[model samples]
Target: MVRPLAVDVDGTLTRPKPDRGVDPRVFEALRAYSEEAPVVVATGKAFPYPVALCEFVGLPIRVVAENGGVVCIEQGDGDDPYGGGRFGDGVVYNGDREAADAVARAYEAEGHALGWGAVDLVNRWRETEIAVARDQPLAPLERVAAAHGQEVVDTGYAYHVKSPDVDKDIGLETAADRLGYGPGDFLAVGDSENDAEMFGVAGESWAVANADDAALSAADFVTDAAYADGFLEALERATE
Candidate 1:
């Protein structure tokens, strides 16, 4: 059985779209899961974004942000109440800042606005990952990555330009380091292309019913429900 459950925020727990809120029931499920084992939220989202979600859940869990480039374990008010702030519990990997900047410039050159829409919140704070627009206009972005020897991936909400050497699985592995979790000890849940990396690496990965065909094909398990409901359903089974 998995010791820590790695969850994806947007399509997996949220409304399957960016800037959406999580259902209160979803938080309930997360709390329940936390009671059994460590819980980790792994997403392409930036820092405080993860912080915001943790605040909402009110359950301290580790955050693997920026598609695994940045990881933070919440500092509990006191008492080490949640078993957070442990594990490889810190920012594990960040791509070259120069590479991130160049990718940002490339997005602009391709006529994509860098500081607009869903990516606005993370634009300034993401020092290591180049997160720009979503998949609608991403072929050029991939080309830019190829030119720069970088990697570009879509999270359904946004396309991220990050270090090719680092992926969600890499970040997830860092979180698993202290907990005696090999990839075989993880049960990851996600619903987008960015999630594919973790799906392949985790012991067992579940793609929510709402996930695209590619994502579903990548996972070891596929849920019948969508969004947070799908996640909660999987949570129940994983714990059982």
Candidate 2:
């Protein structure tokens, strides 16, 4: 069987900002690959987003959402998330949402907006961790988050404030266990700092050409292309 594929969303599957959505060129290849091995779409995105992506991408709903705060692996036949599915190991949660929220509150009290503005859907469904818009001043948010016993992580798209104990690796560990595999059995690919922890755990890891410093440092290899092209390149290399 093919090794499990753990991939990021934003900059890994899609193009950078000013461009959006997973590139159509990857759809066929990704779906084909998923037929041979589980494709875990891991990201700092909220749970629903990745779940929906899995649905539309024609892959089973295996995702590490909210930067490792939420993990869902489709095992057995029950598809309802709120019903029998929650009874077993179908879903798992980590991180401290309350602590992260406190950081957001304190940061706003210091006269800084959360930066996404009102009706910010980016974080509307996020169940764990706090995602601040990347345009916000990072240093001040970092200071406020630290005071509240939280840490800030830059994923290029946003600044995530979360518990130091939680990260993508933690999420992957949960996923791997539930799927009857180990962390080292997976091949990971991504392009941001949020993916750094995951890169460190996978048996093999690739940072896209445009990856941030953290991811580049953590990954075992770096693809020659950026964005979705880099993802395709990594996928090809893995299967080759």
Candidate 3:
């Protein structure tokens, strides 16, 4: 049986921007699952985002954020009492300032107008690469990548020029080691390229119907429904 279930927040739990909120049935099912097993909200969202989500759903569980680069455990009393213990401390992996800067410099050397933003980390995933385009156009960023023989990945909130080597799997492995959980013991669910690594590491993995082609191709199962409905279905399957 899966000891802990790791769930992605954005496309897996809720729809992307313009529509934010959990599905009612999905929330209810998650609450029910929390009563029987440990449900971990594993996403790119950091600190307060995970904390607030737990509060909103009334679930007491651990969270893996920043695409497994950060792991925080929620504790204390009240509906939203989090960030209290060392468990709230996150383990950052790929989204490091140094790495981001290095990539930015590479872009500059290529004569591409580069842009950068400090992602909340907690609200993003690793496979979700960032492009430094806060005040620049995406076309220039693409040109920079092309000049460098690289590719720009759209991470929703940011664009990332990334190497194929870096991804969420590395982050998830680090989190598993820190938390004392084996790869075989956990279940992962997601809906994007960023979620690919977590899906690979977990014993059981799932992708939502709305998942990108890459994510769907890698997932163990694809839900008939999308977003929260897919999450709920995956949870039920995992528990069973």
Candidate 4:
């Protein structure tokens, strides 16, 4: 059987630029691959984003969103699409949004804007983590997070302040169980600190060329290309 594939969004699937858009090349690649095996969208993004991405990309609705804070799989038949026949406690939530909210309040009290501006859409719908735009100062945010017993993770695209208890690997495990597999049966791919935990748990892992130090150190292989190009490279190597 083709090994299940778990991939990150943002830096791993998107172009690093003004728009940070998804590379169109990956859409076809993903759609084709999902036909043979499960394709999991694992991201630090809020829940709704990856779900929609899966729909558009023509992949299954297996998502690890909000880091490892939320896990959801589409189990309903087409007749009642998303009508709740899921597994592992049905939309498992490991994160504590209240804690993250407290951290955000403290960070703002210290004069930080969460870096996304007054109309912060990046975190508006986020259910589990406090997401701050990368432009914000890391030290102050980290300090505030630590003060509130939260940890900070840099996903390359942004800074996430969330419960240390949750990470992508945890979500992947949940996703795996629901899909009737294990972490070791999956091929993990990503490009940032948030992906480190996922790399550690997968039987094999790939860090895209643009991956941060944490992901690079944890991955079993590093692609030569960056962003979506690197992601495609990893997919090719996995087949080979």
**Model 1 lDDT vs. the true structure?**
0.76
What is the Cα-based lDDT of residue 105 in candidate 3? Answer: 69
TM-score of each: 0.86, 0.94, 0.71, 0.94
The residue-level lDDT of candidate 1 at 12 comes to 86
lDDT of 2 by residue, 58-135 (tens): 777888998999999886433554455543565688988889889988999988987887798877888889899878
The sequence of per-residue lDDT tens digits that candidate 1 reaches over residues 201-237 is 8888899998977679899888889998898878777
Per-model lDDT? 0.76, 0.87, 0.65, 0.89
Model 4 Cα lDDT, one tens digit per residue, 49-104:
99899878766688999999999876432234445554436688889999999999
Q: Which candidate do you rate higher for lDDT, 3 or 4?
A: 4
Q: Scored by Cα lDDT, where does model 2 land?
A: 0.87
Error of 4 at 136 (Å): 1.6
Identify the runs in model 2 with alpha carbons over 4 angstroms from their true place.
Answer: 76-87
User: What does the lDDT come to for candidate 4?
Assistant: 0.89
